[model samples]
Every structure is written in structure tokens, then in C-alpha cells.
Target chain A: MICIKNFLTILVTFFLILSCVLTAQEGKALQEDSKNSLISGSRSLQFRISNNLTLTSFEGAMISAKKHFTSNSALRFGLGLDIRSGQEDYGAVEEDDNLFELELIAQYIYYTSPKAPVNLYLGTGPQFTYNRHVQDRNYEETGEDAAWQYDRSWTIGLLATFGVEWFAIENISFFCEYGASIGYQSRYMESTPYQGYQDQETTQFRLSSQTVDFGLSVYF
Target chain B: MSRLKKSVIAALLLVFGILTGTISGQNDMQTTQDQQPGPQLEHTWSFQAGISEYFTLRNFDMVSLSVKRHFSNKSALRLGTWINFWARETSQSEIKNWDGTNADTEIENRYYFAALSLQYITYLSSGKDVKCYLGIGPRIRFEYWKTTYESKSDALTRLGGDSGEIFAGLQSNLGAEYFFTDNISLIAEYGAILDFWGYSDLYNYKNELSSGFRFSLSPLPVNFGVSIYF
Candidate 1:
């Protein structure tokens, strides 16, 4: 029964291969560069937001604004927030996981040149995240809720990113960034009915990805 | 050569052939377009987020996002990520004993995976507002599966277990993108993959001795998404 699914996967593989071979002759011509293309240096300051047409992140929305502080340097500040209900169930237990996260970041960027449409940059900032989850479990024999637990944590991290952005049209552009974060986290967890109610606590230092974001910018 | 060796060689040859053909076609297209004026087609960066697995039973269970950059009119590269959420959870039911007496137990399960890949693409046909490309790449995947069982009388006494696996695969695909404007386009693609995974010491409720390896080939690795080129 399991191999059947595997077979389907294999079948899909062959199909893609065949399609690539057969269409080896279908495309038309080389795309040429336009003479009237939008140039990046034309704009001194810009505001950007998530171009997400779909649900891509935990944050409901992301907004950032950037301004040129010097001939080849700039500053940007960003904010991202998410508020949602979370749930965790452990058979006999059901729990509510409510999450409220706010990330604030400030970055300094250096552009290559005033007229260069392709700009390279490096940025660093801080990020903060918080989560609180509650869980409850019950017994079938008792037909009532009984044991429960709650876990909450806060994280503070430092981030660094290096990437580039290209202006493709009049007011819109795309950016790709790769970065990492190092941070400290503290968590508090408590379980009821644990030897008549005991609690556990944890603290740790961690490293994580600060990447990846593909965003759109509408320049003014 | 052994069958394994032959398969590897064939894969290499296949990839080489596609890349060579794409390069030659690019040269031909450039030469032809040099004589005439075409729409200024300078597209360097693009982002795409779309749905996949449209033809399978687990349709629309996968979502993907790719950040692509064109190095030339004919060649491009992309970094992509895929997230799958095909896990289903059933409500816990009371465990029954052979004697028709309630055993007072319940259980739940969840399974999912995440993947990342790097792709190199050559435009077979490129125009100001449209493009068709063929590409190949390597992908890495991490999969997790777990189940939980609880005694109705004690939540803390419940057992939660998990198994993890890592896979590496080579993938190839053919795709097209049509720009509605200079920035936004509708994109679609179908790819093929051969994924290999090996592991020993799998857990089955209690830790048991289990070992295996798998090399799976899947057809119709499909995707449809909106892309913004900048």
C-alpha cells in the first residue's frame, strides 16, 4: 500500500522529464533591454510593504520605510506584527495557544552608486518574539476536563543580512536577502496536577535564520 | 557499469544535454533578435508564490515561493522553498478492551515536511512579455511524523512519539511565465524528482528495530503561482 504512493511519485518524475524533452523547440526569442527602463538612483527615499497575494508569513502585514542619509548610505526601519489564537491538544488534553508577536528592526544600508540601478547592501537589527500557549486534557471515565499546562516564552535576537535590490519598473522593485540571528530566550512552563502542582522553567541561547524575505518596494 | 552506475550516468548525460541545448538556442535567439527591435525585456529579479500538486490526491497541499534572478536574457537562477501540510488529525476515541469494557485511551497523529532547492534555468524562448524555460536543480527535504496516545485518567502519562528523516533529490522541470504587466506575471511549472532517503532505528510506539532506504520517483511535480519581476 505504501509503495503505491511511491509509484505515483515516480510516475510524476517521468512525466516532468518527458515534458521538458518534447518542448525543447517551443520558445521564441531573446528578451532585449528597454532604453526607457526605470533607474534606481532616481528615487531618494522609499516606502515598501508586503506584496504577498497569499498567506506567506506569521505576520499579518509588514511595512518599512527607507531614506537616504548620505550620497551612498541610507537608514530603514521596519515593523511586523501578528496576533492569533493557538491550540495544542494532547489526547486527553486540549489547550489554547494565543500568540502576539511584534518585530521591530532598524538597518543601515550602503548603495553602490548614485545612478546604479542594482544596489548591494548589508543591514543589522534586533527582533523580538513572544508566544503563550495553554493546554488542557480530560479523562473519558470522568467525562470532564482535568489536567492542563501553560507555556510562554520571549526571544530577543540580533540579525544581519546582505543582499541586493533591482528596480525593474517605474516605481516597483524586488529584493532578496539572506541573514542569520543569534539570540537569548527564556521560557516559563507550568503543569497542573504535577505532584499536586509543580512548575518547570527554561532559559537558553540559540542561533536561527534571519532570512528569507522577498519583498516589493513602491518608490516615491 | 552496474545498474546504479548506469542510472547515475544517464542522469548526468540528460542534464548536460538540456543545458547545452538551451545555450545553443540562446545564441540562435540572440542572433535573430539582434536584427530587429523587440520589447525591452530586461527582467533581473522576480518573486513567485504558488500552489502545487494540482493533479494528485493531495492536491493543493503544497505551497511554494521562489526568488529568481536573471543573469542574462537567456539564463537565470532561483532559490526556492516548499512547505507541505497534508497532515490530518482525528479526534481521540475511547480504547475498548476485548471484554467490551472501556480501556480508557485515545490517540492522535500528524505528519509534514519542508524542502529547499537551488535551480539553474535557461530560457528556451524569451520575449518582452513572455518566457519559457527549462531547469534542473538539487533539493533537500526534512520530514517529521508523530503520534500521541493518552490514558483518559492521566494527561501527563500520555505518550507522544516522533520520527524524522532527511532526503536529497535531483529535480528537473519545464515552465513558463507570462507577464501581465512589467512587474506581475502568472507562472506555471511541472517537474520531476528522484528522491533518496535512508534510515535505521525507526520508532514504532515503542522503540523497535527497523531499518530501510528508499529511492522514489514522482511524476507531476506541478506548480501555479503569481510572480512579480523586478
Candidate 2:
């Protein structure tokens, strides 16, 4: 699986780079055409709230800058912040988990036509996440004994997104995106009746999310 | 490679070939469009939420409540909190001395369990109607047992117990959605939870499989939610 994932990653990176070069060449051609001069490009900021069918709920905000390279092509770069909360159940207990995520992204958009208002975007990015788990319980049973316990952890991951943007009004537009990310986490456990267990080693667990988000943005 | 491995590899390669072919087709489309004037900009934004119920298939009956969100159309994050009510009943045989007669004894017990998790979802399809998602995350759980026993003579006894622990795990899901409107859809999902713990000679219990304990459960959950485009 790792091999396959790596292969796909390489393939995607190659294609993405190739597309950027092609788009850049197109931009140069358009610049040479006196009839079609590149218009203005600026910054766009957006906020979105989303839910997974089985994971935690997320709320995020992002600010991005776009530069038009041609009459129909542009490049965008952005930063985002997100907060997540959810709960998990073990046969013996349940704990509530909260996470904070920071991400950076770069994307290239190729406008379909001068007369149309549609563009296809391809983007890749990385995210750093901090997760804290709060285990709430009345008591813990260890065979004949009972006590209290808590758990916490932090993780990091890579993100990739592909989507399309549609502009309905002059300066306002809506966008839908699909994204996937992978992360590895480090965890710790503690107990109230006794000193918490020290660092425990486990496989680099994989954390991933797929989302379909829709939000409105205005270009400044 | 074994036959099974060979078959798996073949299937995978076939899928990859099909995907690359489709992408090449899209590239051709782009080239054709490049000859024309500049391209149009297409954009859309949306928000969605849903609620689901969880049922356990183990010896004991357990139920849970769940809620989730989707940001774009493919990435999903879910936060769920669930409470499990456990119940069991058993019968024992009692012998009466001197007379060859047997009396039946009945016993019952109940327990409470809860779990919380943060999960990330990834969708593989480009289209919204048919989509597959993969998810994984960490989970914390608390379990408590309350037992009440009744004897033939109408005697009652109570046993109180509780346990709390946090485990790391992976979550994977496959789902499909049908849209009745552009902004609203019905979703059905199936997924499983895998939990892992360390090997501890001091903490090992007879009921546990080994010094290292791991457990899995499949929660087939379904929900109906509304998606609003921004």
C-alpha cells in the first residue's frame, strides 16, 4: 500500500508540475496577443463549516492570494486554520477528542473559456494537527479494582484537494472541493489513582479525512 | 506471488490503467479547448450535516448516537458520542436435599459504556452521486458496570464497577448517497473501529485474549441530511 501510495503521489506531482508549465506557456502566449490582456487578480478569503458522516465536526477559515498569469489561468496560495471535536467509544469507556489544525496550500486554476465563468483547480498542501483527548468517567474497573484515567495525543499529516469553482455574480463565487489527508500521531495515558503510564509506542496510526465543502468567497 | 496475490495485483493494475486512461482523455479535452478562447470559471460552495444511530451486533445490545459534517463535497469530519446499555440474563439449577427436586435460579446484570472520536474522511470519486470514503482517528472510551441479582427467595444484591481507558485505532468507511435535490441527499455508510492496547503482565485479565488486547466492531449507520450551497 505504501508503494502504491508513493507511486500515485509521484504521478500526481509530475502531472501537476507539467500542467503548471503548460499553463505558464499559455499565459505567455496570451500576453503576446495584444487583444487579450490579463485582467486584475487579488486575494480571496473564505470561511466554512463541515461534518463527516462518522467522525468529528470541523470549522475552518482560510485566506488566499491569486495572481493571474494569463487571460484564463492563475495561481493561488493560502493558509487555513481549523478546529475539530468528537467522541470515540471503547467497549469499556468513551473519551472526547479535540483537535486544532493549521494548513498551507497551493493551487493552479485553468479557466475554461473567456466567455464562461468556470475553472478547474488542482491543489496540494500539508497540515499540522494537535489533538487532546479528555476522558470523562465516574470510575474505572480493573477486575476487582476501580480508578480514574485520561489520554492525550498530537499528530501531523499531508493534504491533497481537487475541485471546481463557479462564479455566479460579478465579484462573488461559490466553490466545492474534495480533499484527503494522512497523519501519524503520538499518544499518552494517565490515571488519577496512580501516576500516568509513560510514553507508549504504537504503530504510526493513519488519520485521514474526505470532505465535500461549499463556501462563498469575495475577491478583493 | 500466490494466486490470491496475483489476482489482487491484477485488479489493482486494471483499476490504475482505467484511471490513467480517463485522465488522458481529460487532457485531450483540455488541449482541444486550448485552441479556442479563454476558459470559463466554475465555482460552488456548500454546507451539510446529519445524524445517525449505531447498533451493536455482539452478545449484548448497545446503541449510540452520531453526527457528522462535510465541507466541500468530498471531505468529511465526524464527531460522535455514544452510550451503550448492556443487559444479560442467565439461569442456574438448585438442588433440594433428600428430595430429587431441582429449583431454577435467574440472574440479570447491566452496564454502561461511552466513546468519543475525531475522524477524517477521504472520497475517491470525482462525481458526487457515487463516492467512496476512507477514515481513521483516535478514540477514548469509558465503561461502567452495575449489577443487580435476585434470588428465589426474593433477595436482592447490588454490584458496582467502572473502568476507563484510551486506545488508538483506525476507522474506514464506504458509503453512497442519492440526491433528491441539488442541495439535499440521503446517505448510507458502513464502517468499523479497530482498537489497540499494549501488553501488560500487571494489567492482563483472564477475559482478555492476550497481554495485548485489541477489539473491532462494525457499526452500519445510515442518515438523512440537508446540504445547503453557499
Candidate 3:
């Protein structure tokens, strides 16, 4: 836990410095008309750093890329991984108990204005997810240690978002979006945690979004 | 022909017609990977990456990526590399007392591999819109595998170990590719893989076939990718 805090503190501090640098472009060559004229027919690539960095205690990074299809439209894709651990019981002999979640998203975006200093866009797309929980336990009374796990799920659902972006400079922008996602999971499974042991299974519906995401984009 | 036979023949014809339309519509361009975004007619260069899932049950998987520079429609020089990582954890239960209660034992194993290959690729039929490339070359790989076992029953026991092996061998394959656009293509290839059994001397597992060479088919033939020409 201490490690996770320190990591986040350092990352936030680093981004603070980067934000200061990007903000210093206020008096630079960026004009309101420059923003609009560049939006139509021109192509740009974007790099983003987002919420996944501090979203969980497990500690992971989320990065996204967007390729402009036209001045007012683009596509964004992102993937994030979290590998968190817990000794479900401190008394258990085996220590590396873990839960894993992987999230993937592809979104389509359309902007309201092609040539504006600020742009409003509506985005929607499909989100894919895989989550699993596992642990190992030792029964001292029976002189045996067994590995067990409950509920692994793979799910897909539609996600929609509405957002605004301020092109702080000619090629860099900061944006935030409010989104919701709900989807069905094909299987919810439980087993002994052995590589191939199967025990129980069920169907499920997954509500797996945080409702809001804010990030920065640098395009070239 | 009888009415039933005529209906059956018509259904078969419809299926074949749909198949042909789909295939031609998605002509997945496989021209020279070097076909740059220009008016030039040369199909000379390509870059490809592939994902493999042939051994999921064995807890193993791999990714393969490659690039080729074609000198002519018939031949080219290629460089490719791929990485693989596999891990498995399982257990054994001891029913020593023949009771419903038990002691559980566990084992965990992990391995990673990276390979580098260089080869000369030759086209047997380099048609303008469709083609197949055949290649054979020397390949080398770096492998690291590790295993750990833990038992916490009557007598708490924990054990762990690892092994590393470097590999060298020859690989050959035949693949067909089609170009659908100026800069995109879909390709499928399959053929003999490297001689993995040659390492029998290190593990002492293949003494029966020491005097004879062994061959195995490459596991994937359905890898798709985009090509950029320069």
C-alpha cells in the first residue's frame, strides 16, 4: 500500500510539471482560427494518459491513441491491465494470491465544430473486459494447502460518452468525458484454481465503468 | 431431374455464388510489402505481425512479427521476430487417510521465449494481384523456463527452480497473400517449423530418435496484418 501511494505521488508530480509546460504556450502561435482551419481534412495522431494510472490500488498505467479520420472525427483505442494481490487470510501459507482485470475499448468520435478553439464531441463504442479472482489456502488441521478461485468473467458492452476539449495550443488538448456502460458476461466460472480444473459456471450482467474519464492528448 | 434434386442443386449454386462474391470483394491485397502510397506499380515491401493460440490447453502462446524487402516479384530478404510467455499453476490432493478431509499440494511454472530469424523468401507464383511466398532460413531463439512447487501439509515444504536454453535451427514455410487496397493485405501461411527435438541431447528425452531428424508442422496459418509500401 505504501508503494502504491508513493508511485501515484511521483506520477502526479511529474504530470504537474508537464501541465505547466503545456500551459506556457498561452502566448504562443495558437489562434482561435488556427484551431478551426486545421480540423477539416487534416490528419493528426494523439497520445493520451488517463484515469487507469490511479484508478486501482494494484498500480497500472492506461494509455490511449487516437487517429483522426477527418477534421471533425476520429477513433480512439485503449487497453489497461491491473494485477492486484491479497492474502485473503494472513494465516494462509501461500502468499501470492491475486485478482486480474483487463479492460479494452474502441470509441468513435464526432466533433460539433471543425475549426474552433474548443470542441464538443459525442463518442460511443464497445468495451471489452476480463476479470478473474484467485487465492491459495493452507488447512493446518488437515495438513494440506489448496488453491481455489471464484468467478472469472469475460464481458462486452456498449459505452457512450459526451465531452469537451480545449486545444490549449495548436497540437495539444485536454479533455474530459462522462460515460456509462452496461453489458452481459457470457460466463461466470468457479474452480479449484488448478490450470484446468472446472467446477461451477453461471451467466452474468456486468456494469464496469467509472462514469467519468479525463485525459490529455498530444497530436502530431 | 426430380424436384428435390433440382432444389438441392439450386441451393448449392447459391452458396458457391455468395462465397465467390465475398472472396472477391475483400481481395485483401498481398502485393509487395514495399508498395508505397504513390502512383508506382511496384509491390516491393511489407510488414506483418501475428498472434498465435495453438497451445492454450498447454498454457502456452506466442506472437510473431516480420518485415520483408522484395528485390523482385520472385524473391526478397526478410527479417522477423516474435516473443512468447507461458505460465501454469496446478495442484495435487493427498487422500492419505482415505477421509473426506485433505491436504493440498501446488505447482507453478513459467517460461518466456524470443526468437530472431533471417530468411530469403521466394515467390512460386507472383501474379499481379495474388501471390505466395516460400521461405527457408536459419533461426535462433532465447528461452527461459522456471518451475516452483509448494507443499504446506504435514511438513511445510517449498521448492523452486529454473532452466534456460538457446536454440538454433532451420525453418521453412509457404504463405499466400492478397492485396485489397494500396496499403493493406491479408496473408495465411503454414509449413514446417524449427527442429525443436534437436535439443533432446540437453534433456535426454529423445534418445530413440538421436540418429534421425524430426519435423513438425508450424501451428498457425491464419495471421492477418496491414502492409506499408515505400
Best of the candidates, DockQ: 2
> Per-prediction RMSD in angstroms?
24.1, 21.7, 26.4
Candidate 1 lDDT by residue in tens digits, B17-78: 87678778978987885754333344678776663234222222143667888777788887
TM-score against native, each model: 0.35, 0.29, 0.34
DockQ, structure candidate 3: 0.01
Candidate 2: global Cα-lDDT? Answer: 0.48
lDDT tens readout by residue for model 2, A19-128: 77568767765544422212445334333322432322122223444566764666655544434444443435434444444545555655555334455566555555
Interface RMSD of 1: 28.1
Residue A135, candidate 1: Cα error in Å is: 2.5
Clashes of each: 18, 75, 23
Which lDDT tens digits does candidate 2 get at residues B34-62? Answer: 55432111233434445433421211001
- Where does candidate 2 stray beyond 4 Å? A1-40, A49-115, A132-152, A193-209, B1-230
lDDT of 2 at A109: 55
- Candidate DockQ values, in order, are 0.01, 0.02, 0.01
In Å, residue A72's CA in model 2 sits off its true spot by 6.5
Off by over 4 Å in 1: A1-80, A85-97, A137-145, A170-174, A193-197, A207-220, B1-230
Best by TM-score: 1
Candidate number with the higher DockQ (2 or 3): 2
